[model samples]
Target: MFTTRPEIAGTFGCVSSTHWIASQVGMAVLERGGNAFDAAAAAGFTLQVAEPHLNGPLGDCPIIVHDAATGAQRVICGQGVAPAALTVEHVRGSLGLELIPGTGLLPAMVPGAFDAWATLLRDGGTWTLGEVLEFAIGYAARGIHYVPRICATVQTMRPLFEAEWPTSAALWLRDGGPQPNRLWANPALADTYRRVVREAEAAGSDRVAQIDAARRAWYGGFVAEAIGRFVAENEVMDASGERHRGVLTAQDMANWRAPVEAPVFLDYGNTRILKCGTWSQGPAMLQTLALLRGFDLGALDPMGERFVHLVVEAMKLAFADREAFYGDPDHVAVPLQTLLSDGYTDARRALIGEEASLEFRPGSPDGIAPRTDYAAAVERARAAHEAAGSGEPTVSRLGASGGDTCHVDVVDRWGNMVSATPSGGWLQSSPAIPELGFCLGTRGQMFWLDETLPNGLRPGRRPRTTLSPAMALRDGVPWMAFGTPGGEQQDQWQPIMLLRMLHHGFNTQQAIDAPAFHTEHWVSSFWPRGARPGKVVLEGRYDLGVAKALQARGHLVEMGGDWTEGRLCAIRREADGQILAGANPRGMQGYAVGR
Candidate 1:
């Protein structure tokens, strides 16, 4: 029932949502004689329109590119930076609120996607933005979809969108922004799209004009400008970038720019990993793999007792470093060298005994920094998770953030490859710049509310992001390029999927469709201050015997219900030059097609 054109040679194969916008974008690039980077960029831009609630053209994207020819790898940091109007004290000042409420002006960054598109184009793109974006513009104007998931999710948040921004509320809510299943359209947004295209054509490579046009529509455009003007004509944004902190003027929108830089790399055995810097847990991926190598996983069989225990131990160690050290490299001193070093991996691996789980609790380590605050940090995380109550958590029970994002993979006929995890959150908090058809991401909540923490809120600094896209190679060729969109689950899922696919000889679909588990069971790895400990959680799908087995062996085994949250889309290039791509069944809206 779930099949597509099988492993064809010289065809552009892509996987994304059921919506034609993403699919059409990929197909368009193929038709235009462009490669996978071009196809992936087009799909990302189109998803912004088709899956606006989840992602946007103005959202942030982290990408991994594999050049099959030179066998070189590159990662692009498409994440945006915080506004100049933010500070550490402001976050610490707001004590009682839950670390900035997960949404609003505070977390919004200068959108980074356009710059990523431009960079991909600059590096090597045969198609123009106008060609790639046509399908998205048409869908925006004509309004062609309403799947069960989107419709249901939208119904729940209709009032929130309307109350925050009337134009979006109108476009989203239909008759005056209050109904659940109402069909809505924004001719205002259609006009904005038209204006952006005309402006892009006229400006000619002064691409800032196109960006300016989108920014104006989202902020000072016909839809949102009146709201901004009435709120505060001269109320400039203050040091706390939180929505309430800034007047969020059109000027603020005009000044933002996305940075494009080379990704940080680590060599693990024959595989080279390209990851975004400390802003996300890209480096930790390599660290986990390094530690896991110390054990003979192949000897234990894929899902057997010994293999599972070793992986769990490696994950615990990786999360230990993740919680204590990883943060925005530009802001904090992340111990990248030590964490990925063979010596560190060897020491951490030595702690794991072959027969039983370690008696030592998670985060039971000496302080890597000056103050000896390790014990205190652990206690806080333990208290918080325990307070939240454990056992069988889902999106609704977790007080779900509107963090739904999209992941897509493209493998071109030319042996080039691309993996991009593009993301944006709820649109209400930071009002959209009307004409832009996109809103700034309120990702600021990723930081600590405490001023003393390493990831304190700051201006011009990029928040420690969760969107990590990655590429894996074997024998200097593109073996797999994959990633997912499950906030805290991103890092945990990455290694598990690799083990299933690489070590176990599973097909792309088999590895992605299989049930999996993660150890970082909480709000974010950055939480739970000083020496608090937790248990290892397994999926309910795993046999009860395995849980009992781990528990008997000195491990805490919590059971997640039978449902899976991580959706991995991947493509494997066979030795015969055919491309095999697969998407997870969990994503009802997902699909993969090639021609």
Candidate 2:
């Protein structure tokens, strides 16, 4: 079997991320005696600089960390909440919109990535805030080679920015709109981080105190002030095709903080899969796993038509539940236990037929009726999504897709591990805050305007985000941390890697290198959500016979380019202290480094 690259192996540490620069930064942190937590923070911040179109300082992240010292695993909820002033009534009555816009300040939530990384550093890391942020600051100040995709994204939105977002035009088009593969600098963003470092240094010499000070500077101090002013002054265009002012205020930033919580996990034989709560799309993967547990997956070929069809059908059922039930658990009584219960999974599993089902079927849990007009909503969203004519290179068939996301995985010699997906805050998401050099994230676009649904827009409610990262423990020990960067396809790409590793005896690189596929058969989480019934998009690497066979079973099969499916990355730590890492070769960006 041909492999894109050898699995990186090391005795000290390993790092894998969506960008080579970020992976190198993580390795540098480990080489400098930082733990996995510190390395992850460094890599994560660096990703914001290296892949600015994919993510930025104002994005959100859901991080899963495994501490080898205490043998504990925890989830840091980096997803920000809706503003206290934002409500469904306001969007519908005041803004005269059916759904929250996918771009502009109206969809901005309190920036959460900075606080989450700071929290990780404060609690589990061994380095100062200054140390972890140095790479990002340097890259932003001195400039780094821009990815071609970044140039393309900027070009696509150039007219919009020039006409409606002067601040964005000034920043992105400063040098005649950043040339592809050319070095580009964001001095304002660099200064923003530098100011935070200065504020932290002013606090004290204690590392923990410095981290806390940085957090304060971000959420309550200068950064917050700038963001507040930008939103208040700007009325920008969004997915609704109308200009609207944001309700997010400086007080919201001051009132909000990232919280660390327990991860939801499922025991599958000897492996335990961990993910964030229902506030994210993480649990859908677990639900899919539960549905898959009753089947003899080991008996089937990993890439066979039967296996692909089964996984795709199971995902559709799981995502339907996601649309109907998944939300911020703090605000709603998510029947999580019931949804994951054996009986519930059994009922949902039975719905998967040999012939692909095109209808959206959200199971009735706890006697609660699933949303009656979900298909109608999907059609509306599909119309808008198609009209927008916007999509990233991968997973474009669904959603108001513009910017993508990024992922990072790290493991240290001490067995500390972290898996994080950081996204939102694309340059095209909103006008750049001139003072900050980054735009607000439009994550609130995931919130529906329908008050009847679980993910309805409400004051202070967290959006049901699509960003999900995964961690797995084998025999009560940290084993693997993995994730990717697709909006609704995040969970779709994960199971393939896991199934291959679990059933086919594939190594990390081999599993990641395998062809991948996903179904766009559910309502997307992004703006102008779209659903293509019975649509199965597969990489061309898959056997042609399999594609024909899937079509024979009622799937609307579409063949994507070989190596176009996923940018998955993974890192594993053995009990005996060996580290192995792998990265997707697709897009020619992701890399894994170890020594």
Candidate 3:
């Protein structure tokens, strides 16, 4: 399944996966004069068939698209919404239980990825849902060309497959064990895909109609009905918001919808930065860049001690603001202008020592407006839960476990581009709805049970999302499109990679191939497992003297082996009409194909 480099002399497209067939489908879109967005949609659809462990057709997507024809930039908020059945009381009730993280059971919301696909087609894409989805259906019905990555992941999670969850077990295992490499397609999944196709076709023969029909089938059509029957048979929560188990009901599915909002754009010096709405940390990336702009960053070598130090220090200041002010900005008055103003960045930058690092602390959320009623509501909910008798903790206060996600970046020959991070959840087998073919995302786990917080559960409220797909336009031309699939790491990686390209003058491949460093709890907003409690993980390739220098400055430094960091894919549109694309060599991919 290894991809050989494709020619990029003229038209081009690149897709990365453990499966080769998926790449070809995307390449076909490019060969047929489809724009980057169209090709991305096709590739994304194909992955559902080729890489089941990573995404389901029903997973979530966060997409950033740049149209060269008009210099218009677009973002599709593919993140799911809280189910109608998800009440403040329900979240409060689950707070202390292991299931509070919204894993392995009825989820807080339905998957919104299919809705994104439908949106893309309705807005800019040319292909029909049938055309884009055919390859996925084909791979699902026929057989997938398997590889080592799939085999490894399947083997790792084998015990979950042996459980009584019929759909999860049947899909991942054969003969009561994990499925091995090179096996033919699973008949159950094949049947599911076939039914999906039939349902869509029945819904409407045209692309838009078919897509809408498919989504209906996923939520309220045959699949949801089947799910209802299963839930009824099992005595789980029914369509009504009553308790067979606890949270989630058929009403939630009927009420689900994705929001379309304008991206928050910031002007830092001459550069224009785009961030996800207040529900995500994308704004902090802008704030960090603003802080760094106030410094003398050009004085140091790109990879030298001074450069990394400045970036990390600036991020700490920005992230402190993140913990304090970032949430649903509509609900919480995030003093974003003040936070990004010259005054704040300058003050934060001045606090940094020239040679020594300092412990990170979150900045005050002082001038920002707080939701007093929301806070009181949470307290009331917590009291009610306490009054009723609570169960063990469901929400893992520990950071979210790595579930599954994939990213793609495409810069067309004409400077059109698309960057997207599509992700899935990690709820175990017993929790997933069989007809959906994927687990519900654990995104709601990001919300706090504290009613005082703006991010607490509310009707029609969006959770704080971690994904931010991005595209860069320079001189009115699409210059760069890039994004990654790391949850919290998503915030840290964007600036580091973008700075490498803009300031260090590293080409796409060089930036991606270069070693990366990440700070743990002491530096990063979200720290990963096994990281020494107060240390940052630096690549071993970094000079020991640099680490010593950092440690001397009061920083705790940890070393990282290969590939424990992050994955990135990027494409740059050169002054000429050529597109230069590079995946991360540190990852399982890093090649551009064109012809």
Candidate 4:
């Protein structure tokens, strides 16, 4: 089988990401003697500037890291928490909204990406703040070629920006008018980074002190002040068809910081998959793996109808559990142990049959009833689809305000590895803060308004975010670091890549380039949250025979464009000190580099 591109190989270091600029920046850091952490931080910051429409500095990130020195793996919880004043009562009673709007100040959470990256650099990296930020600063100041998707997104939101978000219009539009397919510059954002660097440099000559100083400047100083004022004074129109002011304050930004915690691990065969805690949809992947463990996956054709149907059926069950049980562990006690137990997965696996099950069924873990309204969720999805037709592609949806996130995977010569998914704060999500050159993320939209649910909107609770990143280790050694940028499809696309690699011995690029499919049978995490019962969206590259067979099994089949399913990237560290990397060619943006 031919891949779109060659799988890069090297003995030094490797980097892969959604954008070529970010991948190049990571490679440059590696070439400069920095490790994987340093390269990942640099690439993560550069992604904010290179793919601003897909992600920004104010977004959230959930990163998985493996250190060779200690043979320890940890997850940095970069997903921001809801503001202190944001609660179900406040949103439903005071704001008079049924669901959190998908595109405005009301849905903004505390910005976590900047602080999280800084934390990683401070604790694990071997570079200065100024060194890592230099690439992003240069790009924002000198300007970069505007991608056509970005231009089209801006054009779609031009009317909304002109009427609602003038600050965004001023930053993205030229002379208060549309400018497409030209080199675009964000001087304000460049100045913002420069100011942070200047503050860090002034703090001291020590690298750690300088990093701490940069953190202060972001969380306690000018950055926080500007964001607080903007959210407090501005009222912007969101997905609710009305304008509303946000509840986030400067206090929220100051009070919150990203935390380092242990990853939830699942031992599958000889490989152990690591994901973030229940706060993300990561464990859903673990549950799927658990269910599939009962079957001989290698015996089935990798792209056959039986394989697709079995995987889709298992995914539906896991996602159903996601809607019912997953939430912030600090607020709700997730029956994680029971959910991942072999006994439970065996019972769940029994539900799989020859025909597709259109019903949403979440298991009773530990004999506790699940907390979700399947019929209501289905009705909401149907109403939303009727009102807004099927949403656009990843890059064009919401006028590019908020659709997908961005991913970076890095592995250095010394065996240090990091897989980080940086997302949120899209150019179309909210009005850009005039002085900051970025907008707030609308991640809070993932929270349900009903207080009775486990994932109900609450003060200080992390939203059950869809931003899931994955890392796996073989025999207690870091083997692979991989992830994608789809909101809900993050975990769905991962299993295919893993199966191909484990069963058929596919290389990184071959695994990523293989045809993929996902079921939208559960409620979506975005605005107008809806579900498509028995729906299976497959890439057109898949064999037509497989599609027809799936349809015969009662799947509401839909064909996506060839190579339009995922934006996955991966890097692996071999035992012989060699590094391998791969990136998706679907969007014509992702690239992988090594040498």
Cα-based TM-score, every candidate: 0.82, 0.97, 0.84, 0.97
After superposition, candidate 4 runs with Cα above 4 Å error: 175-181, 389-401
Query: Candidate 1, after superposition: displacement of residue 21 in Å?
Result: 4.6
Residue range 205-297, candidate 2, lDDT tens digits:
999999888888899999999998888887887766677899899999999999899999998889999999999999999999999998889
lDDT (tens digit, per residue) of candidate 3 on 212-315 = 77777767766656555554455222111223343444555656655666777666544676667777778878877887887666567766777777777777
lDDT, candidate 1, 1-595, per-residue tens:
1222232233445544334458567866777787787788778766776666677655788887876666677767777666565555555454324455454454556666666665665465556556656666676677656555666665555544544445445455665342333334445555665765665566466544554454445444542454345334322121122235432344554555445556776665666666777788776677778888877666666655566677777766676566566677777777777777777677778877755543332332334652224455555566655754864232222223355678888887777888888887344334454544455566666666554455556676667777888877776667777777776667777778777766667677666666777654323532222232336667667778877787777766788876564577777776677777766566465656665
lDDT for 594 in candidate 2 is: 91
TM-score, candidate number 2: 0.97
- In angstroms, the error of model 3 at 341 is 2.4
| Clash pairs (backbone) in predicted model 2 | none
Candidate 1 stretches with Cα past 4 Å from truth are: 1-21, 67-71, 94-98, 159-168, 176-186, 205-243, 247-256, 354-367, 370-400, 428-437, 449-453, 521-537, 554-558, 561-563
Could you tell me how far off, in angstroms, the CA of residue 531 lies in candidate 2 after the best superposition?
A: 1.3
Stretches > 4 Å off in candidate 2: 385-401
lDDT per residue as tens, model 4, 1-595: 8999999999998999999989999999999999999999999999998888889999999999998888899999999999999988899998788889888899999988998899889888999999999999998999876678887777777877777788888888766433555667899999999999999999989999999998898988899999999999998777777778998999899998899999998998999999999999999999998998888889999989999998999999999999999999988999999999989999999999999999999999999898777777789877765655654332233332455789999998888999999999988888899999999999999999976677888889999999989999988778999999999999999988998898889999999999899988998888878788998999989988899999999999999989888789999888788888999999789999999
Deviation (Å) of 40 in candidate 4: 0.6
lDDT of 3: 0.61
lDDT value, residue 43 of candidate 4 = 99
Better of 2 and 3 by TM-score: 2
